[model samples]
Target: MTTINDIAKLANVSRSTVSRHLNKNGYVSQEAQERIDKVIQETSYLPSQSAKSLRTKKTGVIGVILPKISTETASRVVDGINQMLQENDYQMLLTQTSLDKDKEIAFIKLLQSRNVDGVILLGTNTDEALVNEIQKADVPVVVLGQNMPSTTSISYPDYNATVEMITYMLENGYRDISFIGVPEDDPAVGILRKKAYIDTLKKYNLPILEERMAFGDFSIESGYDAMQTIMMHSSQPNAVFVVTDNMAVGAMQYLKENHYSIPKDIGMATTGVSRLSKYIEPVLTTIDFQNEDAGIAITRLLMEKLNGYNKTKKLTHTYRRLSGNSL
Candidate 1:
C-alpha cells in the first residue's frame, strides 16, 4: 500500500524529485538519490505499472518467449525482434523455456496477468494445453516455430527443408543415410523433420531402416549419444541428417572422439545455420531457415494483429541450403 507520495514525504523530497529518481529521467542529486534509495529499501516500494497501463490502455512492451537464448539461432531471432521493437518505439521482455512445454504454458498464463501488449513465442512444441492458452489470451499471441493448427503461427519449412537437405546428401552419393532427431511429441523439428527424411528416402527408392534412426533431446550430449547409437549398429550409415545444430555439434564431437573423421568417415548435415558451424572442422551443410528474417516477419505479424488485422494466418517461412565440407 505504499505510494510515491508516501515515499516523497518519507524521503523529504518533492513528488517531482521522487518521480525523476524513480523514472531515471532527470537527474537527482547524489544526496537525493541516497534518500530515495533508503526510503525505497525501507518501504520496499515498487512502481505501479498497472496504473500507467490503465491510463493509456496500452503498454509499450512486448513479451517474447524463447526455448534457449544461448543458441545462436535464438540469439539472431532476438536481434531481429529487438530491431523491430526498437523501430516501433516499444520495449521487449524476454524469457526462455529451455524446451519445456509445461513452462511455455505457465508463461502464457503468467503473461496474461503481466499487462504485455502482445506475445511472440519462439516456439518448439504445439501441445493442446498451449494452444488453448494462446486462444484464450487477452492479447494477440503469435507463434514463430511450429505451425499451430489453431494459432497465428509462422512456421519454418521443416518438411521441405529436411527433404532438400536429405536430397542434397543423396545427390552427393550418400545412400546409407542415418537421422538424428528429437522426440516425436514436438511436431516441428521432431516429427516433420523425421517424416521428411523418411519420405525423401522412399522417393529415392532407398530403404528406411529402423537401425539408422535415433532421437535426441536437443542437447549436444544427446546428439553424441544418438550418433554413438547409430554408429554402433552393424549396418552403419555413410551420412547423417541431424535436426538441430547443437545436436550436430554433439554428433561431431562423438565422431572425433571415436576417431571417425567427418565426411571422410560419415558425412553430416543439419538444420539451424548456427555460428558453431563456422568453427567446426569441415564446417557443416545446414539448412538456413533465416531465423532473423523469420523473427522480423513474425513480429510484423504480431504488430499487424495488434492493429486489428482479423483472420488468423499460418505462414511458412523460407529457407535455403548452406554448403560445407560435412556434406
Candidate 2:
C-alpha cells in the first residue's frame, strides 16, 4: 500500500504540502497540486480517514442503530439516510439491535468509543437506561421513532394516524372493527395506536370488545395468530386495524387462508405501507409515514447538532393515508 509519505517522496514535495493538497484546508501552490495529483493517480493512494478524524475530531461517519434490518421500512430509511449522508461527504456505520434494548444502549457507547460524529437511533422504546445513554453520549444522539426524555427526536403521528384510519373504516360501515397491535413498551405504536382504536370506537358509541383485540410482537406470524384468535372468538369483526406492516401482512394471510375475502368478509387498515402493498391482493389501505423522508430529516437533525445547534428538537413527521381496495 502506498502511504502519504511515499506519495510525497514520489512527487518530490514536502509531507505538509501533500497533506494540504489532500485536505484542501491550507494553501498549496498550483504547480505542487498538479504533481501531487499525478503521483496520487499513478499510485492510487487512499488517505487514512482515521488520521483525518484525529485532526478534525470528525470520523466523516455517523452511527445508525436500527431495531431490525430485514424489514422494508428499515431498508427505505437506510436508503434515505445513506443518500443524505453521501451528499454531505459522510457515511454511516450501521448496527442492528434485533429489537434488543440493551444492544441499542451498548452500540451507542461502542460508536462513541470509535468517535462517531453522531448517532441515529431507530428506537423501539424510550426506556430510562436508553435515555440516560443518549444523554451522556459524547456525540449527539438523535432518535427517529420514539420520543426520548430530554433528547432530540422525530416521532411518527401514531395516535392521529391510527384514529384517522379507524375513522375511515367507521365511515365505510365497519362498525365492529377489531385491533391487532404490539406491546405497550413501544409507547407510540403499541400504546397510543391501541388507545386510538378504543377512543374511535367509543366516539361512535360502539362496544370495545375484549376478545376483539390481540397483541403481536410486530411479526407476521404473531399477526396471523392474532387474527386467528379474534376470528375464533364468539363475535367476529367486519374490519381489523393493524399497527405495523409485517403484522398486517400476517393478518391478511390468515384471513385469506381461512377463506375470508378482504373488505367483503373482513376489512383491514394498517400503518407503515409495505413496498409490495400495491401488488398484494386487494392492496393494503395503510398510513404512508414516508419512512425515507423521515430518515433524511432525522439525519439532518443530527448533522445540525453536530454543526453546533444546541436546542432539543421535537418533531412529528407528516403522514398521509393511502387508500387501498382492502378498505
- What are the lDDT scores of the predictions, listed in order? 0.90, 0.91
Residues 83-126, candidate 2: write the lDDT tens digits. Answer: 88998889899999988888999999999888789999999899
lDDT per residue (tens digit) for residues 1-327 in model 1 = 999999999999999999888766798999999999999999999778766566558787899999987888889999989989998767898989988888998887777677789999988888788899899889999999888968999998999999989998999999999999999878988899999999999999999999999999888899999999999989998999999998999999999999988889899999987887789898988988998998899899998988899679999999988998897
Clashing pairs in 1: none
Residue 25 lDDT in candidate 2: 88
Task: Tell me how candidate 2 scores on lDDT.
Answer: 0.91
Question: TM-score for each prediction?
Answer: 0.83, 0.91
**Clash pairs of candidate 2?**
none
Q: All predictions: root-mean-square deviation over Cα?
A: 7.3, 2.3
